[model samples]
Target chain A: MAEFKKADSMLEWFDQRLGVVNFVKVMMTEYWIPKNINFLWAMGVLLTVLFTFLVVSGIFLLMYYKPDVNMAFDSVNYTIMQEVAYGWLFRHIHAVGASVVFLVIYIHMFTGIYYGSYKKGREMIWVSGMLLFMLFSAEGFSGYMLPWGQMSYWAAYVITEIFGGIPVIGDELVVWIRGNFYVSDSTLTRFFMLHVLLIPLAIIGAIVFHFYALRFPHVNNEEGEFFDFDEEAKKYLAGNKKESKVVPFWPVFLSKDFFVLGFFMLFFFYLVFFHYNFAMDPVNFDKADGLKTPAHIYPEWYFLWSYEVLRGFFFEIAGVSGKDLGLMAFGFANAIFLVLPWLDRSPMVKPANQRPYFKYWFWFLMADLIVLTVYGKLPPTGANAWVGFASSMTFLALFIALPFITKAEAKKVGGK
Target chain B: MKEFKILAVIAALVGITYYGIEPYAHHIMHPEVAPADFSFKTLKNVDTTLAGNAENGKVLVEANCIACHAIDKAGYPAIMPNADAAASYGVVPPDLSSSGRIYDKNYLANFIFDPVSAMHLEGKYTPESGKQFPMPAYNWMSPQEIMDIVAYLQSVTPKVTEGKETNKATFEAACGRCHDMKYAGIQATTPKDNLKAYMGATPPDLSQYIKSRGEHYLHSFVNDPQVLLHGTSMPRVGLTEKAQEEVIAYMEEIGDSKKAERESLGIWVMLYTFVFAILAYLWKRKIWSEVH
Candidate 1:
């Protein structure tokens, strides 16, 4: 027994945390990760990885590109067609990565929302994630304008110029933004700085906060249960009375995460390496001309819903043009999205616990988003007026009505 | 095992965050100019004749008119009231979307070469109209390039609508930061009480000012306002002589509907930061629990 204890003592000395050498053991021993984590729980981790990929690849491309209306297009082309080896792949990855990051974040957020991940102890994570999303969108917009392509210039012109429809100071603000009359070198440089440095810093800080807050409360399972660790199981492993119910990281959670990570990595590699040619071509392959507007000036696909909303308002509305109304509605929609976590303060975190009314909202919100996507891609004809009206209503319903619905449902579920 | 899972997740997150930060930083570090579709070869579809290629025309405009006449929907220049909107001698910059609608090629050519003819400084649009455009002449623009500009403007269309308020508020918010006060409403010369009533921080009403001020004053004011009005708030509006003439000729549309929003977020940022800090402090100290 004494000899067995001596060997155990050596193993115990090796099982250290933080400063100790048995770091892996210590992590396996003390950390309290839930056993029944689902695929949704892995989304946050995946998004973090995707964000890193976007930043690393974006830096490599920026080294050679210029941000002037005159030279920005050529510089991007030169990098892709001439200078950088497989530069096209890098650009595609960065572009797709941006969309993917948004995609992942949206899923993660929905998961959080569906599960009541913002209640009580997890509020900080939800808030931090919201901040990250806002920064990400800004970064995406600023970067989208960099290629100085037709789409890039038009997107910048359309979005930036949207501010000109304001009650006053429209033109001056527009000029101030462009740093000249239109999207010139100054505008490109300014946007470049913003996209790369300022927004990224904010994203990094927000992510740090997100994880820091998450660490204290860990992952909330789908069943909406407070963590209950088995101390007797812990003590049995520790050779003391405090037995722990902890599962091994390698065979259980690690295996699941690794499998998912591998599948995503394979898809990403295929996307970057094989099927890479895409439509960021206007700027890289063509020169920007203010007079020659494209037949369709659509935003990147992820921004389609809001873009559709903006385009739909080109008709007469409450003493305003469709365009002005579109702009206002689009802004309002985005503003709501930024504040969603706070807006949804439900106590339920799982499908079973959710009230039927909230469940209906959840499913329909997805349908509305799909409708907006379709609306964004299509031209607004007289025939589409009803479609526009319906799309707008759906967006408002999802944005404004659902929060109250969720709150009411939460009250009923809690028997309050 | 649970501890190990946590550590693995943390490591994975750190690795990914590093990857995301760099390229995203790079892409944003220098905004790449947006790409343009150079379908100049396909201009046949649009049925617009450009003396130069549309791409070249855009570059030419950038070099010439973009300094003053904003072609992009976003960069519309500040329009002062012309004699039409002026009290006695008021002048406003007209929207140039239909410059082709308003002027023929010969008139545009002469206007580009000499502002006096177009402004009718020597006479009027017709003696019956009794109105004159105080357009400064452009000795700098070549007649061919002037024709090209005409061609470009002919291709342009106006998309302005009713709710798009082009008011004093909009002008000050959008164009005021750069142009300063070369235009009228932007000038600090207006009395505070009048300005507050007109629309706080309103752009000056330039209709009478432009008509009475004439081409020479408009030209010199835009070129170097310090020479005319000492310590003027207007920055040197960097425009070529041709652009100055076109802009002066076009300051015609000013109304309450066409205004911009003042996007000063300094106050909001300060306010939010204060709120967040308070929240953070309360959260850290557990003050909220004690209250509850």
Candidate 2:
């Protein structure tokens, strides 16, 4: 047998009761990862590191955070940032982590799609990861309300008001979610609970699910080549290391992860200290005023693309109201991501690099999302409105065109 | 190199979004106000070339200012207490100790000549039926005497810290009479209704004005409120160039208290992270070499 770690008596005693050594073998030492995967694969682990940063910093912020409408703004702005020692550091870490985590997530999501990691039997991995993202987004929206600032209050108000657009029980559902006619103390307190306790627990569960799902299908290689892991792992254990296409997950894989993580920390903390203001909206510095609405309101940049999709249907088409059409389109945009594995019908294993049309589609989709995000921030007036309409249409059109393009590619390859 | 290409794209996108687009969007949304004038050029001129002796200025301050304004650092208390003064004039006349440094010298000289026109409160502070301002125009006083009073005020003032504290005191001197900074525990010296009676409405509580209005907006608005919000009751406070900077610094401090700490710690954290990343790269190379 190939020895992973030489065990002593103390380890042996624990190993007998807990199956500690075997557990490590199954999870890490014996778990084989393809060697060809590049640093793009490391985005998943970077997200985990960022999540840990958020949780640790969030716990510190929780110590001083007061959820009451009267006290919430001051508690965050004064009690934590000014009064408590080193509190600013923790707040910075949490605030910056919230925004920076999204960058890694988009990278991970795109990397999966790019290499067709979401294809074959790996759909569960992508789905579970997407679940975590939705949960994280929920967490962000809820946590934003706890600050009780002008933007936080107004953003919560605008977002919850969207639920009232649902067909039948829409207005009642809005009342149920907010627990009032408008966003009030009940809404704030409930969101505080979700942000802190409930959603975080869901995220943790989703993280475990995501990781476990990846175990069966294995991490997809850069070129989407699937060789037998057992044979290559045996070769690695027998010391014909260069010939093996797999590496032990513990020492070999984790070392590389740590290197990526170290570089990520360089980027993350640079933002935490030097450029934290980007994460903190200046309008939110003022206390929440219920009577007066801010002149201009835009969601944070991460949500801007999706938000623009919701706003893009500017004209009435057929019988539907523009808002209802926009709302339906927005819903379509969000739900489309979940079905990506099924939508792509390519016989070609890797989606990019080899496939010419898919490569162009990927870049076009990326450029479209960026355009949507930019237009989302600008006022929807004159030509800016038309640009948003076209971009959002393109976002949907790309996905609708995906199956046709991939089917043609499959026929060209002369495969199922 | 591919990673660097990704990094460059990310940097470019963020740079475009934050530096380019955000400002451009703001400009489109908010009407562009004229830039602030610290020199008091908007006001009618007061020739500051007229030199005055400190000894002469001290006598003028005693005669003209001490009736309602206190020179506490100079051992002159107001003859009327603050409550009585507030009862008489809609707002209590501010103490004159720091006026030499905080208020523009030209503004001080001209304000003494005509209090009504100097503050741009011509309609409100005029000699109307029981609505006249308490501090009457000292237009009868000569220009030299007004400069002397300013010099005397400068002499008697306690030393204010150059940047932060001076700026804070300047904010208090210029803005505290009409505005409330609840975040900083500063309530307006003039009561809300009193200010409403005097200026048509109570000005906003300015606790987070630095954040809501932003630096550029605040600079222009504070220098001349009429420029941005035409017909605004808020008068141009006529602060000196240094005093204007001090006022902005004070607002920034209240709004972003951790700015100094964040800035100071940034370089060290960056250095540590860079070194750690370098070590990790070295370790990664070493570990990969064994596999090869």
Candidate 3:
């Protein structure tokens, strides 16, 4: 039996039973992150701040929020917005947190891409991060349905219906997922369960896995300068830190992260208070009616780029339907992010600055996503249809062109 | 410089998307429907500044308007119950108790002179279209007679109190006829089915309207719906400037009650974050100075 021996202090007693001393040393003091890393590296911690915002605000909303089709609208719009004191503030923080989380996620993802942080041994960190991104997207979409507004109802209906476009188990899959033939009370209840519980738990798991994964390869930094952590940690431990090329994760690295977080909160709370409408769609204020559809319907800004890709294929060609083909393309777009490590053949261990071809690819991908997002919000008719289709093709073409460009870049790696 | 370049690219990409594409796309999709008759330029002869004897105005209103609208504040009742009125007119006739306070004096006179033309419903309520307006034109009445009736309605309706609950009075007078405020326990006076038939769509409850339709859009659309939706059946209620403001403010009170709290709290939160940001920066500089 592991018996706790009486010690000089409570801390020493706990450290004897649990390896608290070693745990802290391993996780914080001994763990190293690159010193040369820029402020963009702070995005991961900023995402944690956003998650905390959503969780805390979500708990307050859940106290009053009903999941029924009829009651959900009143619960959110009337009880929370009107009756409960400062309910509007909680709702605003949550809605804004859900939206801004993605803004940071995209930056985090793009930052990874720019620095080739997903290269070689660090693939698991990127993969785990993408998993969290996917989980967060699900979390956001499900929570959106809890409002039971026109946009909420229809967005749910539209997204769930997209699953019906799959090949064999399509129709049945849609029914099972919705728990009804159409989006009804059952759909709302199940979505409510996933939103408040199941998916969020999964996201927590993924975030834990992501942080755990980061410990392995450690964090890749701004210039993609590789460091032997074991070797550098000794120098850091010996108090000769100037030449260590690394800093401890806790006090040294986190100081910059907290600074970035404070700055981020300034922008966040400004939107939470003054510019709230950017997150809350006006249409969502109207109670959900299955019979009535809004004149213009689209996902939130974060999902618009991928949604545009889904809507981009406007025509049926080569026997397959456009709807089915678009679904396939959308699926590919989502899955492609997880496979970036295997696709880029470049042997570079540096930022996009040091690699010319990969840098262009990164910018092109950014611009194409912007174009897709812009065209996504517009009604897919006339010129929009053509541009959206071209942009959709470009999105897919970027991934296809990845190995080709990077393979060529491998030849230039040694010269640099 | 490289980091700065990266930040520039991000800012430019975001700017082009939000400021450039988003607004442009919305402008094209939902073109700003400028108010067509904000000044009510269609009615030229509605001169409300004319003097009228309250006694004469009361007599005229009793003779004509009391048959349909119950001016209960003035001790007049409609000749029929609400159901019978709804069955006959396809909607319950609104009580005229607060007409003097809520409706603009010019609009009241114009509405009586020609119901269809005053509301710009000439396109819908035409002889060829067979869609008769519920309220018939009182064109036979002299201009002086119409003005007298309007004056009588105004005089009979009690003056809205200066500061207290004036908002509620204006809201009830302007919108209580067709819309339900379920959260406040104020059901629509007219039946939903009757309203649906009358206006081609039932008026939505106003409890969450401030949140649903933003403050600016609500003001514009309430003043004139036809500008935003060309074929909308909602008639221009023609509220006076003060009455309109009161009603919109009342909607905000019910729908967005925490607005004051939110704004006040926002100031503190913003200041806290800003101050913390500066402190964090200083701390980071000190900590990093120890690092290298």
Q: Best by DockQ, which number?
A: 3
Of candidate 2 chain A, the 10-residue stretch with the lowest lDDT total is A1-10
DockQ of 3: 0.73
lDDT of 2 by residue, A1-416 (tens): 54546556888867866899999999999899998877887888798889998999999999999998889988988898888998989988988899888877887888787888887888899899889889988988898788898889898888888888899999999999998899999898999999999999999999999999988889888789978888999999999878899988888888899898898898888888877666888888878889878877887778889999999998899989888988899889888999998888986678487786688888898889888887888889999999999999999999999999988887887773
Tens digit of per-residue lDDT, candidate 2, span B1-292: 8767766866676666565336666677786766777766655545678887899987777666787788777888766865666667878789888887778777877878776577676645445544665677777777778778877877777877687767778888899988888779998887777778877777777767787677887878777677777666687777887788788888888976777887888889988989988988888898888887
Residue runs of model 3 more than 4 Å from their true location after superposition: A2-4, B1-5, B20-22, B36-38, B45-53, B78-81
Residue A8 C-alpha lDDT in model 1: 52
Best by lDDT: 3
Q: Is candidate 1 or candidate 3 better by DockQ?
A: 3
Provide the global lDDT of candidate 2 against the true structure.
Answer: 0.82
Each model's DockQ?
Answer: 0.01, 0.54, 0.73
Badly placed stretches (over 4 Å) of model 1 are: A1-31, A166-170, A229-254, A276-284, A352-354, B1-292
Candidate 2's C-alpha runs over 4 A off are A1-8, B1-33, B52-68, B73-76, B79-84, B112-165, B196-217, B228-232, B252-255
Ranking by TM-score: 3, 2, 1
Model 1 chain A scores worst on lDDT over the 10 consecutive residues at: A276-285
Task: Tell me the TM-score of chain B in each candidate.
Answer: 0.29, 0.78, 0.90
Residues forming the 10-long window of minimal summed lDDT in candidate 1 chain B = B254-263
True contacts kept of each: 0.00, 0.61, 0.81
Q: After superposition, how far is residue B40 of candidate 3 from its true place, in Å?
A: 0.7
